[model samples]
Target chain A: MNKTLHIALSGLNAIDSPGPGVPVARGLREASGFDFKIIGLAYENLEPGIYMPGIADKVFIMPYPSEGIAALKERWEYILSVSKPDVVIPNYDAELLPYIRLNQWLKEKGVASFLPTEEQFEERQKYRLTEFGEKYNIPVPESHSVNNLSELAEKGKHLGYPLVVKGKFYEAGIARSPQEAEDWFLKISHKWGFPIIVQKYIKGEEFNVAGLGDGNGETIAAVAMRKQYITDKGKAWGGITVTDPRIMELTRHFVTKTQWRGPFELELMKDARGDFHVMEINPRMPAWIYLAVAAGQNIPLATTQLAHGEEVKPMPSYEPGIMFIRYSWDLITHVSSFQEFSMKGER
Target chain B: MKINPNLAINDTGFAFDPMTGHSYTLNSVALEIVQRLKQGQTEEEIATGLADEFDADPVIILKDLLDFIEILRNYELLEHE
Candidate 1:
């Protein structure tokens, strides 16, 4: 009989702009080496994965990272007392910092997690992309972070029109004119706070590579996919894996240079000259990560093993031309489950 | 011969590449070219047959055929030579 590993993970929204939790759970379920019992950590009760069948054996509501670390730790303490997890994987960007801070505490409590260091995480912030690009010798779009609309206009002149205005954490809009740029600046700043990132808009096809890097400067797995269809929210609705050696080489270079630990996704743009510009680097698994598992490299599975400090062989090859089309599914369940989770903070 | 072997085309000009799961809808002329390519017709042969059937300038037909082939190449419906 295989030993059961209780894996606790967050980001269970599974909405249009999905969290990576469901796909990660699905990937974990497919692991051949161990039996996995999933514990879902959610901030809201309405997260679809909470009630979705075959997703989680237990669901617990945790305080948001914005609520401060003390509240988060208290909630985790209660959770750990009840349903002990062998490993915890926090998938949301906003929550990653708190989890990283609590890594050693979790280790003391016998819960393992593999995550990027504080310096590694800080260096890849969206506002610091240009510096990151220069440090790593990667081609990145010229960008400037502005504190107010006046600074936006000042920098907009240098960068020219049709620039991409981005928030620190989420939301990005393409502004073709000064007025449009101000509109985006106002919208993103109001929601995500100051230091709006304005980037030079590169005209070309976008490709994304999801990879897992060993802490010692080696890529364990990398899967590249091009978005066939994009939604209004800028998430890939349909994507196909491609055989691009250049992109693969870049992925390795990124891992080697960063000595990046754990899972990351690189958003890249290939211009007409076939040169790739590093667009953004997400510090965790992407929502379309299941596509990687289907193509032959199981990143989530490898991440789980890494979290447990087990040796994982590099997965160097995956079948290209594999496609993944996202579709929505409606899960029907009683309101009682919602009530139970809301009242007791666990169900 | 350069067309992807995994491609499947139906009577109504619907093309699907099973390997990549990418589908394309071809026009009548484009469909004819794909079918001819599938049957091992060379570019010159396809151009000649298209010119005779349409009673048009051979040079124009060949140019248009080449453009369409470039589109196919961009979409990765053709195998790497």
Candidate 2:
């Protein structure tokens, strides 16, 4: 048992739209095997996870990813000089690019992180999801990128009506017509920038599986979920773990095929015919990750253990039917502390 | 300008307008400006105070303040006036 490892985590937004850090940290805290300090890395001072008592021993603000990779290095180098975390787990997709670039640098600095290679990241992107599915022989709904509204019709002919239009990074909207698709294309493109992805809308049950890859095509642990209640923003407000051999089989195939090296959430749909259609691949852990721990996988714990070079046996079975109901908590804080964190960049 | 009476804000930058049941996540600067607005500080006074505290042009700060107020109104977080 590692007695004192400092683990740094990012993406702590626990709002309507959440980041996975808080729940991931929850798993680490509940880990029966290790005692560690939780270092919260936030891009904004009010990320909610920073202010939540018992979640973060200390919190530090980081430069937004838009500031680019060089700035990321300088900022992280500074953060490391002071706190020197044993392992860093970034829970946001936007931070993955910079983290992949910083992987070797942090390792040299004695900070460990498990992440997918740059190639895996790119190939799994929405625009390339179809290509990835084709390469892996996995079933994926056909998707194409549209740079402008003019290109929507041409690019979306095969996709058909009631398709899903998604931003390159974050926003996604279902468009029932060309007009709605065009409107969403404009909205998403305006918000997340260009190269919007238009995908075939598969009407079925959405199942999400959160898993950790052992970097050599083996899945360390896997937990599948079915949302009992979906919020207006398309987030799962309540979900239950499920025992699906096919989803488990697909997860094994995916991680083994990609030699995936980190935490991943596979958003897949099961059509009437019982075939799994891969909708999207979230490169990091999902916000509902605590449920994985509740279901007995303890993926965050596995991830930290993997980062520390500990041998983790493959967790092949988990007690299914465990459910997680998401809720929002109000954390009372001080204006002066917020100001200090903002102006001084430490909390 | 004043914050809507039914609106509630937390130090963590969470704002909820119970009247409309809408919530917003404010940045630290926006929260500061919103707090001042709730205290009934005028735009000019808020801008001057911000400029004194942070390194920014008062004019730009006021302009940004107005923009923030406009956003507040759009979200129905501010009074009609």
Candidate 3:
């Protein structure tokens, strides 16, 4: 028998807690022929074994002595020494930069790192992926990168009311008018710095697809899910399996066109024109990963097998029209916070 | 608990209860337990059969079966016998 492939998932912060990553790991372990282990770098107390059973084989907690790139590098070195995984997959956007740096170090250490190249990373941060979509005739919203508040206001007016103001690299806030867009831009700029993108809000049904790409432009398995409900933070609270062939083909085309490697999720919104506009590409797993396993694609397992150069079988067809009610533990929590946040007159 | 005789369950795990206008999705294991319950099997007998079939501990199987029955009761899919 072939040796079991070992993998490590980084970034165990509170934001991208073990809650999300654990399911993916567990699904992989159950479905694929691999021995998966999660290496949580910070807050060992929040390790995977505590919450998620049968997912993490070993959890390595690194020293959290300080906060900075230098301290993080030290922790990475410690992690590399203790858990010598064949590949490292980062789980959060904030951790991407440091993991990229660690990837550079891994190249010298003779360990393979799975992440986008530096140039590709920079392009993604600039929303240049939209241009790639446009090349392949993938519908993208009318969006423009802006550097100042005046430019945001100008574009917002041009795009009309109900615009979405987003950071060039990440989700920021969705606003109803030019003033609201400007206010959102100012607030985010003050807190996280500038260069945001403002786009016309494409109103209609939204859908997201999760899949794994072979890096050679072949998508292994893909699952389409239509959002039945959404939280204010854009998390899918309820969804259902969709068997739309068009959505699947579009997702495959886009991922292949980008030559994307690793697990990816594409967010798409169907406009009033009945055209699907590409929203954004999350280069990691979504929160609803368990639903995918429950509905049957098992993307994390497929990705792990591909990473190990093992032959991955095609995903078996599953029943469509299956609805997933994401038990909303935090729905009440969000409602309370929204009330308090509104009372403060803050968006 | 009681199951409405009018309710129909398909082999593929789809359950339709006309009395409540509610449909349910049950895994194969849950479906099997529900079917046996509807066949008038006692809780202990159902647990014993499930334990033999799935190679699970009898106590754990009984607990899980009871929980499933409670869930069905809560959904109004079952009534007290």
Each model's lDDT: 0.91, 0.88, 0.66
TM-score of 3: 0.68
The predicted structure with the larger lDDT, 1 or 3, is 1
lDDT of 1 by residue, A40-136 (tens): 9998999999999999999999898889889988988998889889999999888989999999998999999989998899999998999999999
Worst 10 residues of 3 chain A by lDDT: A10-19
TM-scores of the first chain across all predictions?
0.98, 0.98, 0.80
The CA-based lDDT of model 3 is what? Answer: 0.66
Reference-based lDDT, residue A206, model 2: 87
DockQ of 3: 0.02
Please give the distance, in angstroms, between residue B71's alpha carbon in candidate 2 and its true position after superposition.
Answer: 51
lDDT of 3 by residue, A1-347 (tens): 15655667644332322235655665666664555555433344434232334545555544343355686677667656656776666666656666666666765654555565555456555346456556666778777788887787788778888888887544568898667887888876776566787777888778888777767677777777888777776777777776666777887787677777777778888766547878877777776766678778887666666655567765755445566665522212345533543343111
Query: Model 1: which residue pairs collide?
Result: none
Task: Kindly report which residue stretches of model 2 are placed more than 4 angstroms away from their true locations once superposed.
Answer: B1-81
Best-fitting candidate, scored by TM-score: 1
Ten contiguous residues minimizing lDDT sum, candidate 2 chain A = A319-328
Tell me the DockQ of each model, to 2 decimals.
0.22, 0.01, 0.02
TM-score of chain B of each: 0.93, 0.94, 0.90
